[model samples]
Target: MKVIKEISLLREALRDKRKDGSTVGFVPTMGFLHEGHQSLLKRAREENDIVVLSVFVNPIQFGPNEDFETYPRDIERDEQAAYEAGVDFIFYPSVEEMYPHKAGVSLIVNSRTNVLCGAKRPGHFDGVVTVLTKLFNIIQPDQAYFGLKDAQQVAVIDSLIRDFNIPVELVPVNTVREEDGLAKSSRNVFLSEEERQQAPAIFKSLQKARALIDSGERNPEKVIAGIKEELDSSTSGEIDYAELLSYPELERVEEIQGKIIIALAVKFSRARLIDNIIVEI
Candidate 1:
């Protein structure tokens, strides 16, 4: 696999692949790659002729108090993982290269940006949309792969594609998790030993929520309370926000009828984590 840190060099690499009749598949990620990221790459390789995985820990997506500087990164290790995952090029661009001029304007998908993760971390998805728009513009991939672990982020990106008419296929891959059921994330490293043990409760709580919905529990308050109750009883983790919302569109729902997304964000002693389950009721 080729690693190109310079934006021009990366574009040149992509151009070569495009000229050779290769369909580009892009996986945008902050570094600290794990099996979850690898799964996205593997899927990309299966469908596309060339896979470009970007490893820029976008500063904009992080809040002022968030862990922008401490976000884990090791380009060498990331490049190796990318190579093993069948990536053709690693687009590792610097902040300066990404934003040479001031960001005079930004892309935002409204309504979709005000719940769950967005409610807790204001302006988070705006940064996500902006950086993702930049990456999509640069890579111009035939298909872009994103993990379903971040369901809200997936929704926001899809909205951007529709609202802006960006001509690239957006693919949502399944959420990858640890053996113990905790969702794999770069921030998982922040968990202390006890927090790591309690972290899986987030997933367990979501699973229970799904079970309740599957059992014909449609009242949003009941479903949400059950989830919160699980977290309250079994863990010391702080509840950030828990809600059941309409799938894809993400509008908050009082009663789930057809398809709805049950999502939650919880903070352990260390870092905040988010998870969701989409179900048909």
Candidate 2:
């Protein structure tokens, strides 16, 4: 596959593709390619005439104490995986290339940023929206793919697209998981042998919560309690947050109705893992 590092070069390449009446599908990712990322790229490849995958570790999306500097990177491996997944182009831009000067204004995020991972990591989604805005503009694809593993992130991007009238279609792909049910993540490498064995409890608890909701449980507190009980009994990891909230908007709901998300984040010894299940009630 062709790799373009400069912004202008990538834009020119895309312009040429558009002139040929090819539809572009974009998959934005930080490197350390895995099956989960490839799943998005494969789907994008199937849907669009030209598929573009970006491998930039967006520094702005990371917090001060976060693992920005230490976040994983393997461009050579990522390129091979992208090529196998049928990617047409790889946009591997540097931080300087992405942000040459200090931003004069920021994307005003909606109230959805006040809960879940957002509540724990302040300004995280702001960085996410800002970087995504830049990527969307650069690629100008007909469709963009994101995994449901970051359901809240998908929700925020959905809101951003609707509010800002971004032309690209936001395609939400289902979360890819291991045989044991733990959501696949780059941070999984940090999990100790013991921690890896226990990590599946996160997804197990989410499944329990989904079962409880499907079995006529309408109270949000009760559903959350069921999930927490499972996590407490099964895993040694510390619970970050186990919540049941409105889907997409993430607002607190008194009763479980319409659509809702049962989300959780657990801090193991080394890795912080997150998982969720979206249910229509």
Candidate 3:
């Protein structure tokens, strides 16, 4: 696979492909390739004539004290993985290439920025939307793939695309998980051996929540309480939030009716892990 760093050159090449009537599928990611990322690329490969994967660790998407500097990255490893996942082009752009000028304007997400991960990490989605706007413009893919592990992120990007009238089709792929049920994440590398063993409990708690819901429990508080109890007994991680919110919209609900997401975030000794189960009642 060819790695193109310059935006102009990448666009030119993609434009040439378009002239040949090839459909392009894009997967945008922060480096540190994992099974979760590969799942998205694999789906893209199956659906489109050309698949483009980007590995730029976007600075704008990170907060002041976040792990941007220490966030895991290995371009060589990522390149090899992208090639194996059937990527046609790897858009490995530099920071300057992505953000050339001092941003006079930035995209702000006003609505869905007050709950779940959004509530804790302020301005995180804003950063996400800003960089995505730039990437979408440059790649100009017919379809873009994103995993549902970051379901809130998928919701935010859905809104962004609708409001801006972007032409790309946003494909929401299911979260890829380890055999033991933990959601696959790049941050999983930060966990200690013990922490890693305890990590699967996050998903287990979500499963407990789902069981409660499926057994005719409709109260949000009771469902969340049961989920907390499971987490309390199963792992030593500090609970950040165990919330049952309306699906996609992520608004608080009095009763767990219709489609909802039971989302959890826990802080292990070193790594902070998040997982969720979306259910329809």
Give the better candidate number (1 or 3) by TM-score: 3
Cα miss at 250, model 1 (Å)? Answer: 1.2
User: Which residue pairs in candidate 3 have backbone atoms (N, alpha carbon, C) closer than 3 angstroms, thus clashing?
Assistant: none
Worst 10 residues of 2 by lDDT: 107-116
lDDT score, candidate 2: 0.92
User: Tens digits of per-residue lDDT for model 3 on 172-226?
Assistant: 9999999999999999999998889888989888888888877999999998889
TM-scores for candidates 1 onward, in order: 0.97, 0.98, 0.98
RMSD of 3: 0.8
| lDDT (Cα, 0-100) at 260 in candidate 2 | 92
Compared with the true structure, all predictions reach lDDT values of 0.88, 0.92, 0.91
Instruction: State the lDDT at 62 in candidate 2.
Output: 87
Off by over 4 Å in 3: none
